[model samples]
Target: MPVFNNKDITLHYATFGDKDKPALLFSNSLGTSYQMWQPQIDVLQNAYFIICYDTRGHGQSSAPKGPYSIEQLGQDVIDLLEHLDINKAFFCGISMGGMTGQWLAINHPERFHHLMLCNTAAKIGNEAAWLERAQLVRAQGLKPIADTAASRWFTPSFIENNPAVIKQLSDTLAAGSPEGYASCCEALAKADTREQLKNIEVAITVLAGEQDPITTVSDGQYMVDRIANARLATIDASHISNIEQTQVFNQLIQQYLV
Candidate 1:
């Protein structure tokens, strides 16, 4: 129920674990809330001070005008850290969140000790594809994409076996404001961090989903190849690899952070 007051926007955030522990910030993907990291919080709470926040245009955060930039998103994180009097924290982001992480690691290098990019890319999709999706969501609704979100988010086998998880995520996605979701789509459409990879000097770990169609393993490798002190790990899951392969995801992060 806590919120960080930015100049133009109000961001909703939650924290777990003790204040004395090292800080870890978690950012969510498009169409997801901070709740998406519940599984991670469950395991990491004992070892780290876990911070989770809803991105602008998603969850309870204020959604301003259309088409937010990665820089804006990254700055929000900086603002949040400043609000909490935090100097540095370990940062983890997936999909849209990862794109924001790239911006932060490149422009605000001192803000993070380690950066973990999960199932994301420097440039997610082509300009045309993201634009089209944005238009579709604006004209129709989140339901249009939420209907097939499971397919994009998880493997067919995982979807078949985990109906409840699929339902829960899809519901959350569908509940998002169409305007907010579409604005984020426009942000992703124009976001191209490929050129900034070399600027990231912090220790980095990039994980990709083997079965993911949205952000594949190849995308992860592309990042690791460009960033110094970076390595790529492949998980046997889809775009939402953290959820589909929770234990493996947690173990990889725990090992990498330590």
Candidate 2:
């Protein structure tokens, strides 16, 4: 329930484990909240101080206006770190969060020990598509997106077997703020770090979903090829690998953080 204000925005964040432990920051994807990281937290809390926060337009965070930038999303993390008085941490982010991690690594390399980009790409879908999606959400609300999210987020088998999980995530997206979601869609529309990938000095581990149709394994490979000190790991889940392949994802986290 802890919250912090960064200028005009208020971000909701939660912490686990001991402050004395190494800090591990978790940033959620476009439509999800900090709670999306629960599976990882349940396993890793004893070893690290985990920090999970909702992005500006997601979760309990304040949704300001429209057309947010990747820089704004990245700066929010820096502000959160400053608010918590943490100088350095291991960062993990998925999809849009991964995009934010790229911006952070390129712009604020001094603030992180390592970064894990999961089920994401340096440049996601085209600008026109993102803009169109933003417009669609703004016009029709989140139901349209939420209705089709499962197919993008999980494989058919996982969705069919995990009905409750799918419902929770879908419902969360459906209930999310329309302006906030659209604003972030606008941010993603302009977020392209392909040219800037080579500039990232901080160590990075890109986790790709083998079954992910949104951000493919090739996207993860592209990042690893450009980054100075980066590697790639592939998981057998779709876009939301952490939820679909929890044990394997948790294992990878522990492996990299060590």
- In the range 82-126, model 1's lDDT, one tens digit per residue, is 988889999999999999999998999898899999999999989
lDDT of 2 at 159: 92
Q: What is the lDDT of candidate 2?
A: 0.96
Task: List the global CA lDDT of all models.
Answer: 0.92, 0.96
TM for every model, in the order presented, reads: 0.98, 0.99
Instruction: Please give the clash total of every predicted structure, in order.
Output: 0, 0
Error of 2 at 245 (Å): 0.4
* lDDT accuracy of residue 66 in candidate 2: 77
Cand. 1 TM to true fold:
0.98
